[model samples]
Target: MANRTAMIDVGGGFRAIYGAGVMDRMMEDHVHVDHCYGVSAGSANMVSYISGQHGRSHTFYTQYAFRKEYASFDSYIKNHNYANLDYVYGTLSNHDGENPVDYEAFEKNPTGFTVVACNADDGSTKYFDKSDVSYDNFDIMKASSAVPVACEPYVIDGVPYYDGGIADPIPVQKAIDDGYDRIVVILTRPKDTVREQKKDIGPATILKRTHPEAAEKLMNRYQTYNDEVALAKEYEKDGRVLILAPESMYGLNTLSKSFEGLERMYRAGYAAAAAIPAFLGS
Candidate 1:
């Protein structure tokens, strides 16, 4: 059997709804994953995929994503963070105790589950695994999803960490280093889309002036994403990597809250996954 790994990229905000559809289709097709890696919003999707709760992930986007409190401007005004960490934590905690994630299954998983976060102080990447006792799954997930100014850094053992995408967006290199024979990457954007090279303006201008370090990290993330895209293409030739991306995302962006747009992205993701012939065999 091939040692298969899934590398889910950091989809911006509700754009991660697309990843849910990809995961759901993969599960429905019975694609076996030996290892899983994710950063930022992708970490949430990773948890759902590994736990076989893609339905819950779907509900999260379709039902809970549009809540005014989820990404409240009021929270941003008061706390300097648009993301309501408390609300996010409560939702993921499964407070009702119904259909809790099977953390124990991580032990049985081949290469186990891994989430990446960026150390805020040193600007270094941190990889947290289920086997690591230093931080629990929630800590890892929260830290990984903490998107700089959009979401406050999560403190673990007195050290703060932000979104893993700041350091490594799509960690195809990490999966390659881990000895996965084949890797399947789920991308939120179209494969051929070119990143805009416009000068920093508006919020980016403010970020650079106030939080230069955060600005630098964002730049690094962009460079890393481009580099990984090149690497993925090179690996694709050898059948070592397969990438699934939407042909187009219409006008939907990371922060789009339109229900119609979110639904379109979700369906596109599902169709992309289903169209991959490799998945049928896997």
Candidate 2:
């Protein structure tokens, strides 16, 4: 059996709803994932996947994601972030009674799982695996999903960490380095769709002025996304890497909150999974 792995990229906000569909289809197809890597919003989905919880991710995205409490303007004023970090943290911690993440299952599963987060102090990448027992699994997930400025950094062991996407969005190299014989990549955007540079004068702008090094790391993530795609493509010819991306965004973006858009993205992801070749034999 090939050591197959899935590397889910940061989809941001509701865009990550799509990944739930992909995971659902993979489960239906009985794709044996030996390992998983996820960053940013992808980290949340990764937890559900590792837990072997069928339809739990889908339920969270469709039924629970739009609650206004998750994104509160009052919280933004008080915490410099619209995301109710506490609420999100509690949800991931399974404290709110919503489809709670099965952390016990995650710990017992033989499949390897790794969540990536960005170091706030040095702008470096941090990989948290099951062996990293210093922090709870939900805390690692929260840290991996913490968007700079949009959400406050999550501090673990006295060190602050932000979105893993800031340092490594796709993290294909990490999967390769882990000795996965074949890698399946799940991307939120369409293939070849590189992000265009834009000037932002929001809280992020303030971050740039205050912490140039960390801001530089954030700015370079665009190139990192592209570079990771290129690396995956280079390996495609030999059948080592398979990339899955949405055929069209359908006007859905990272911040889109419409239920219709979320449903569409989820369906798109389920449909895209039909393209998964028999690279990992059943």
Candidate 3:
């Protein structure tokens, strides 16, 4: 039987929460996702959902990952966000019953999971099947979370890896090939426009000092966003894909407020929830 898939893309910083909000509301309406495919923060989101903590995503992000104690001074200087202040570290590192996260549940759950990771040296993407990866959920997420300079590569089997967003942000085609007939995608990034202003400053600029290619990816991220956005519309014409763009979202620049406010994050799911009945023709 063909499966149903829910996909979320790579939105750096807190902007990725839009996908989480969408997933949370979908659960409330009993939308069953046979498998979830995600990159970067989206990968982390899928683990939380599979573990049944979808509703508490806000608290998880605000209180845990962004907690004052977790965000170390070194984290602020090295990686833009407090990657070291990661809440998953506590959950995955400790391996306790306090949280629903862990590799065991993800590996055994009825709903499938796939986390995307990129090899830093070769720039190759590795898709870790939930049932196949040997590491804990946190480790799997860390592999894909190598957010350029902000995130350190997840070293596994002697290879350093980073976020897959640099290459494959959304794996919609992969989900389709995996036999998912109906596809729903939540995007935290903006829809592609004909023209985007050129940015000559910031991380992309600073990064040129060492890693030029990484800097290029940062500078061209808007183009990447547009390319991914366009692909959704092309896939929708095939009769099985639904693209859910958040009605409102804070820009990626504002890290602190990206997932803030009562309606911002959940709004992504709410908009999609309202569209589902019609999409289903029920």
Candidate 4:
């Protein structure tokens, strides 16, 4: 059977709600993320203030650190005007503060697994317990055969966006030894870093130039593949299952192409979340 991949696009609205308390407090006078605005928002009447301000004004500047300048929720419904603050953080951090959340502890918990870690330039990383999962390592040969068995090896190296090197090969091998059938070796890509460089376009010449960072990413991907291919070959003869090239499975298009490729490989299976709406009630 083929493995179905699920690509859930949690809209930005969802994101805002998830971090609403944090944001509301940041708008208060002298609000600062570093200074623990999170706790202050909880203690303050942020929800009340926002609810009261609904349909009232375009820009509602409340006490220190709290500014609801967005157009949607106006408590008193007034004119539509946009006002940009000099620097949002300067106002928030300099205001009243609180204790910062223990992100490390949060990450260590099982719930933290769902909290994604998106790198600065938009490249992201996901966590997996090698004990339960064997990923694709971007090796074409190993992945080619493993598709029939629903195995995938992959790695996301932050090449140009980062250092373009594998994190630690020991952990990967340990997972395999612990019974994982495949492995994914993530390496950062040059395209990501180049994309970051192009965040603010100033000169056409600079934009036209080939990004050396992207090249480094490609090179690293190739090198990583070479290393993993040898490892996969050694394991395959030992009877462990494998399939699905890393790039084909988790490449630029991610779930889209990977699902199709895996489907083609098995010719008898459904996607991971064929029963998604059953759970989401969407």
Best by TM-score: 2
After superposition, candidate 4 runs with Cα above 4 Å error: 1-174, 177-215, 244-282
Q: What is the Cα-based lDDT of residue 107 in candidate 1?
A: 46
Q: Which stretches of candidate 1 lie over 4 Å from their true place?
A: 95-111, 132-137, 197-212, 275-282
lDDT of 3 by residue, 1-282 (tens): 444555554544466676677667766776667778878777767776776666555555655645544444566575554566244544434456344455565566688878877666665668886765554436767777766666556777787666767656767777878887677776665554332526424755765675565566556655765676677778888767777765455444324543354346556555566665445332
What's the C-alpha lDDT at position 45 in model 1?
Answer: 78
Q: Give the range where candidate 2 is weakest over 10 consecutive residues by summed lDDT.
A: 195-204
TM-score, candidate 3, is: 0.80
> Cα lDDT of model 3 overall?
0.62
What local lDDT score does residue 11 receive in model 3, on the 0 to 100 scale?
48
Candidate with top lDDT is: 2
Q: Which ten residues in a row have the lowest lDDT in candidate 3?
A: 192-201
TM-score of 2: 0.91
How far in Å is the alpha carbon of 98 misplaced in model 4?
34
Q: How close is candidate 1 to the true structure, as a TM-score?
A: 0.87
Whole-model Cα lDDT of every candidate shown, in order: 0.71, 0.74, 0.62, 0.22
| lDDT tens digits by residue: candidate 4, 164-255 | 11111112343354434332212111111211323123322332244333233323433443454455446445533222121122222110
What is the C-alpha lDDT profile of model 1 across 1-282, one tens digit per residue? 644555555665777778888888877887666777877777777777776766777777777667766677887887766876556645444434333555555345564677888887767889988665221337777788887667777888898887887778788888888887577777788887655525323344555664566567765566677788788888877777888887777567665567887888888888877654564235
Model 3: residues with Cα > 4 Å off, grouped in runs: 1-6, 69-74, 77-81, 85-87, 91-94, 97-105, 132-137, 192-220, 251-254, 277-282
lDDT accuracy of residue 82 in candidate 4: 19
Output the lDDT of residue 167, model 3.
56
